[model samples]
Target: MATFFGEVLSVFSRAVEDDEEELEESEEDEDILRELEEKRQVRVHWGPALELIPNTDHRLHCPHLLLTVGHNASRFVSVFFLSRGDWDAVGHVSLWNERTLQSEGSACVLYRHRDSHMLMCQVDCFVAEDQLFQWTEQVLSSLEPSQVTVLSDCPAAEYQSAQPLGTAPRLRSIHTSACSEPTCCPPVELPNLVSGLPAAVMSFCQLQNISAVVYQCYSDVRSADSTAMDTFRPAVEQLAHSLNLDLCPDQDVLRKVISQAAVQSNLYI
Candidate 1:
């Protein structure tokens, strides 16, 4: 009698599982597919200078900070901090070309701007080999809500290769010709390129009339979440809060990433 009852219970469970699977197949929602398509982020290419002008609707919000990812051989990437109400350039930060960074072995550039309510803004950067990946999250987390747009991947092959527009200090980098190995150029040895960085950066803040702070966060984690990365979060969050911006992330998703990283590290070690 006991065996017979157990057999009957197993049969009922199997039947219920099959019915639920069928129900799931039959009730699949089309709206979810539509939302997925609607929520996709579009990539915008800035031909020369990195353009960060936002969509018209976004202008109604606060000021937006625009970022341009400099290519390995691209010239100074232009950054515009635009005022939402008037669409005027409140300030800007110009970045050195990639070749220059490789030779200098760091991310250093000159920044200058005007003075206004937007002065003393905060900027935190995650320098990576490729900017397109996780770019949306980088911009969102680093900038004010609805106040960050990016212009990346310009076509120009080399920075300063083309006669640049003005007396803007030209950025240079080491390059390898097809037939030759890597060649290093004599450093341009500009003042700021040497020791004037803090002053130069501060000049931009002063011109914009706002106090500013810039954070350089290392790209040590490949995934969104890692226990090791958690240490960096507080500082990243603090930087955003200083700029009066909120930081967001899916904690559950991040935790999974961290767990995976731990497992992978254990396996390798």
Candidate 2:
């Protein structure tokens, strides 16, 4: 290239400018990914009740930990135990993902018996697949529980059986080696695997050598109903007795719980 003054100038390739722009774009993409990863990380936040507990390590000490995953299980616990007003709000787990609606302490709530060493956690939100393990780890790492019991819900179609499934919900159980007591239901068959948060909790408990049992309920309905919630009553009778929870809540309480759920799920309202 030459200027008007007749001075020769070097010509620069436009490809170099294009390469620089591509590099900048790549850096920006990396930054966005890092931010998303950070945002997706699962975290546990303890409530003021836990902070006031007189423990040297400031950790929640639980003799028996009960975890309920999915809407049916959570509602079952709510209608049976929580309705009795014997529990105190302890803490919650927070996570962000595409399906997350309320990351602020409402989705996954932890409760403790007002007079006993029992702890219960009800997870009513949709946890992303990738965040399940992290959510399990962070939530359980803060507590020292001798026995862990998980109640999970699934569609009946997921169950692998030669015979046709009945209308009633079915229960299947998977327990860790440390668990000595027999389960109320049969073990989940091979090739029919459990996934999501329930599986993550079971795996973590097995690796940590904690006595744990997971009761998975397979229901025909897509949404939570009274029948599906009542299906777990027989399976959890012994646990309810041990925890001194009301095995059969009043009809008024049951109606209230079911009505509230119906109101929330009503699309036409």
TM-scores for all candidates?
0.23, 0.91
**Candidate 2, residues 1-269: lDDT per residue as tens digits?**
88999999998899999999999999999999999999988888777766633223555778889999988898888888888888898788888888888757899888999877688999888889999888887877878899999999999988888876698888889999999988888889877898888889989999999999999999987666889988888778887888776688667877887787788778998
RMSD of each: 19.6, 2.6
Off by over 4 Å in 2: 2-10, 52-58, 261-267
Off by over 4 Å in 1: 1-211, 216-228, 232-249, 259-269
To one decimal, what is the Cα RMSD in angstroms of model 1 from the true structure?
19.6
- In the range 1-269, model 1's lDDT, one tens digit per residue, is 24745753323578888999988876665566556444332232222332345442232223433333322111111111221121223332222223232322123221213322222222222233333233333223223322222222212222222333232222222111211222122322222121122223323334434333222212223332232233233323432454444444345544554465568667566
Which 10 consecutive residues of model 2 have the lowest summed lDDT?
50-59
Q: Against the true structure, candidate 1 has what lDDT?
A: 0.30
Clashing pairs in 2: none
